[model samples]
Target chain A: MQSSYFTGVTTSNGVMQHDFTVGEVTGALWSSKRAECAPLVLMGHGGGNHKKSPAMLGRAQRLVVDGGFHVACIDAPGHGDRPRTAHDEQEIAALREALETGEPVGPIVVRYNAHLAERAVPEWRAALDFLQGVEWVGDEDPVGYFGLNMGTAIGVPLTAVEPRIKAAVFGLHWPEALAEYARQITVPIEYTLQWDDEHIPRESGLALFDAFASEEKTLHANSGGHKELPRFESDSAVRFFVRQLVRPSIPQPDLVW
Target chain B: MQSSYFTGVTTSNGVMQHDFTVGEVTGALWSSKRAECAPLVLMGHGGGNHKKSPAMLGRAQRLVVDGGFHVACIDAPGHGDRPRTAHDEQEIAALREALETGEPVGPIVVRYNAHLAERAVPEWRAALDFLQGVEWVGDEDPVGYFGLNMGTAIGVPLTAVEPRIKAAVFGLHWPEALAEYARQITVPIEYTLQWDDEHIPRESGLALFDAFASEEKTLHANSGGHKELPRFESDSAVRFFVRQLVRPSIPQPDLVW
Candidate 1:
């Protein structure tokens, strides 16, 4: 996995955000020059969202400025800068028509998820391979992951296959294809669960967490919708990664916002 | 809400399983002779399942044999002995076809859920009214609720308007229609969440938990599919109702299994 670095994007803080593409996977890396050889985190975005979405950026900004960690994030297949394949377009069009016509979306969603996971799991691994050797990172950088919704879908399976990631903050939901594979994942994980998600069932979320073969997993559930998780929970997630990857000696903020 | 009892069915454990029709809802009642005028529990089954389904029956059996509670479960609208309406048939057929053809099932599920919720919630309320004054129950009996998937969708709204219900054990997922009404619910709630459900997303399930206005709600999440929740969780739910409704004055079993 080769990468191209463009440091044109500047942030309000001293941290520098750079754009990089490894083949079809496009992602951004945020890091502070002062924080060399810092622990690195891979940010996975939700479905229908890009790597630089407001929510994703908010998290990246905090990790870089407050948590003092280098962060890398990428767009999944057919999302953001990655070109949507013809098959992807067809599926999207069909789903839209069904929704307009008042057809059931469950079956469509299941199939689309399967299709996406087949590609996404591998794509994330490739991005991780590319993110590892950047100048801000080291040959033995302590790696972590944080993502929700579609991000968890990819992260769950990616973590199962790629042992390089030391820890992960995954929450909410995952792909059906990952059912068997989840039992094989023993990564120290911090999984978030929203109490009442309208789209994802509570049982489904718990099932994913239970499937994780990880002996060191903590369930951080809060009251909210799919996107309505509390800031304190994310702060808790930040603290989790710190404790797991970089050691909790770093004084963290009360909130990541 | 009027009721007629037919006591033709009796169980081996001295728990009599009787048939009853309460307005539009038809359900079976399970009662043990040892618990007279005991606390009553209302059982709501998931979609595509009826009152006497193995899962629902197991819950009722536990509440009766161990928890010293009389259990009442009614079929939701368009389920079980209640014949499906023409509209219900059409929607089910379409969903079946979609599943067969690999078409999107989400659109069909949304419509069916909308159709079911419109009638099922009121049906449950009527059943609650009928169950209150039965021969085995007093006019002022304490009532609890247990249901999943479609059950939560109906149980949530039913628990919202019908404050007579003392406590509830609900989980799985809910329909989008319950978003506004959930905030009105103040009853003590015991909700379950499955981690890796294929049909419902985890965030959506958490959103339902967040929507509830209950200040005394506990989220009981487990690892499994929508249908694969561990029995231990259900045992915990039974214990929850016992503590909330009956106060566990009776001896509770070690493992509800």
Candidate 2:
């Protein structure tokens, strides 16, 4: 197996960030400056986003500062620091044209993200292997996955196959190809969707949430467009991780709003 | 309008309790022992429950101690200290029979709660009128409603007509009688329902949530039965009120787990 190693490290706002890579895949790890061995949360960025996107950084900060958990996010195949293949270019142009022409983007996003997941899931497992091997991210604590949109695309399959992921937060994608994977996932889940999502139909979003076989799944459907997923949801996701990853054993930290 | 006055006062666990009456109606108010002028939250109890039920007290404590908000709950007509009418007696017996025979209780609960709402709405308004008259609970700040099951039935209608209620957290009831009222409500809302509820159909729960015209509504559907709503949801509701009521002016408080 290819090894993972840190490329650089930076600290800001009380969070220590380490830029790292698992073979060719670029990733970032976030933890409190006052770090300790804690549970790990693997976050997946959305379509057209990278490991250090503002959304990813903000959520990582919350997980680190509030949850006291080590957080990591890898660039999806053809996203962020990764180079795109000819096939990836073709899908990107097709998605762009669909958006420009007022065409339904669900089919294209679903198909393209599904294809990416096949490659991305294995990379995530490899990344997890290296992450768990690290001294700060010891394998003793259960791992968690937090991702939405294209993140959900890759995460559904990864969590389905990855027994190490005890809980997940996923939403904002079509269920056409992912329902099968979602069914295999029996861990606790928190799924979010937009009630009036312009890109994804309401029924389709609900269908994906319904497909989760996790006995303790929760669906948070907010009334808004696809991009209007409230900022507060990020806070809620932090709480979900705190509840799922830390509990009866550790004294839970107060959630700083 | 019937005037309301406090009949008794007590303090426990840093929460000051006030027993008050509005005409024949009985209700309880909860606040921090170190009281101040702050936002008000009107919480409603579930079916066969009263103002100071365990659930109500638990939630009220969170609002008062955590959110620094005054909280009040009134006994529904024919509940707690109120006398039951002959009609209330008949409905109670019918509901009991349905439960014993493994018959569908949704229809009976829907019909009974709606009838109760007709009387309960006025009493709630009267209680609010008196609550706002108190110096500590001034009318300047927006009011919030929190309730589930029978509480949702009464709260939906009460929120529809009460212009002071700017936000609400309601759920766990059918749409048959409340849909019309829900359609008229335009405030922000947080609704909850059970995904695998034995008593309420999943679609019916979704449908009731659908009828709400609030542009900023959220549906929190968890995987559980009618009575198995997770306790953390109460904490979520408190945060909802803090965000809706506190805002860019008052810095949000830390959420203690």
Candidate 3:
């Protein structure tokens, strides 16, 4: 119900920014919305897009409106407001060269994703620290996390290693990665997949389901192609988040059909 | 793969006069495949078709080869094998009544599916009883079940109440009904949904996901329209069944890129 934007100035380590406002429930303590002792949802975007992607925005709105949660999405290193560094092109070229060599490239891709996840964790931690100081929200709410595609690559490892994130959701990403990370997580999780998504392939989703460790987990299959966000699924995601994060003490009305 | 066919006089229960055998796989038993189980998947024609639906045939073939499951497809109660109990004018009138009242109404359509599922369970039990008397697959092997479309409506509930069924897959049915019955299930399940499916609406698929309770559940999304199986998803279903029932002890292979 309430809205505003805050700019996170660049520090020596990285440039941080929170472009969205806290909702009516979380207020100034948006970042602390998840757990009283935990960090907020550290959202990351997919490739070739910034924090304001329509898909990301739709997902974020569902989390805020239906889940009653606060989110902090940042541009990954070398993405969004942060200017590209000299190594960016080299990093791209190196990836291309690896592909050109026609080697068994699975592990190489995994390692690259791991590096990206590791590099993004510090900024996420800093963002959490900044959220703790905000006046609107308290420090007690639990922190849950989610990301799309490449963002999931970052969020998965960070949530696995970071104790602050108690629950998470990974969308538009391979389920196999989640399966590998499932062993490392002690919290509840929601895994979503597109039935017709050609981009990621359905087998990856199955692999992820096989790997999940949590006793309480859900696999939501909706009708849509890759990158297509049907309204029905968006609504389901919100309810899933609310069920995972919102405390029973909070009286919330149904916001989605 | 072994194959055979059997034909005999119909029983009081209208047992099929013809019986056929498909190939078999060696592994642990699953739903309908118990050592004493002669579980059979029944294929249902979608609409405007008889027992010769190729789409239904494709589904049955997948179950046979990938799932190592048995199948029996018959026309709706009065549709193919059985004699027509009503006139064309009467059937059309009944259809019009159903359309007008927004309720299923017709002498030929008198909730036959529910009865079919109820009847099949005992038949399956008898088949299992017969199989136990034979020397082929041992009782320790897994017995499982599966179905498509209208057959899904019957098979799912039948599997839910039938204890011998270890695992089941349902393709192209109402999600809401599946959700209603999902609460009764205690075995692993695989559900497939097509994102751009032109036949069934998206809401129906979501309703099923909302209701499913299997802890080990997989949902496959594909890009094609209804009745057109996506190659990747179909392959995933085959692998899923093999993983769940055939090789429960073996580690699942990493998803092929």
**CA lDDT, every prediction?**
0.74, 0.91, 0.54
Considering chain A alone, report the TM-score of candidate 1 relative to the true chain A: 0.87
Per-residue lDDT value at B131 in model 1: 67
Docking category for candidate 1?
incorrect
Score residue A51 of candidate 3 by CA lDDT. Answer: 69
The full ranking of all candidates by lDDT, starting with the best, is 2, 1, 3
Predicted complexes: DockQ each: 0.02, 0.42, 0.04
Q: What is candidate 2's fraction of native contacts?
A: 0.41
- Those runs of model 3 whose alpha carbons end farther than 4 Å from true positions after fitting are A1-40, A91-111, A175-179, A199-201, A223-225, A229-231, A248-257, B1-257
Using DockQ as the measure, what is the rank order of every candidate, best first?
A: 2, 3, 1
lDDT of 1 by residue, A61-106 (tens): 7788668889988888999988999998988888888878878654
Model 2 over residues B1-257: C-alpha lDDT tens digits?
Answer: 57668999999889999999999999999988877889899999888989988888888888998898999999999999999999999999999999999999989999999999999999999899899989888888889999899999999999999999999999889999999999999999999999989999999889989999998999999998987787788889999999898672565333210
Interface RMSDs of all predictions?
A: 18.2, 8.2, 15.9
Among all windows of ten consecutive residues in candidate 2 chain A, which has the lowest summed lDDT? A248-257
Winner by lDDT: 2
Off by over 4 Å in 1: A1-257, B1-3, B248-257
Summarize candidate 3's per-residue lDDT along B1-257 as a digit string, tens digits.
14323333232221222332222211111222332333344444543344445555455456555566544444544444434445534665666677687663323333444545554445445445444433444455566555555656666777777776777777666654456677777677777666556656656764675466665555654434666553334444555566666767765222100
Candidate 1 vs candidate 2, TM-score winner: 2
Give the better candidate number (2 or 3) by lDDT.
2
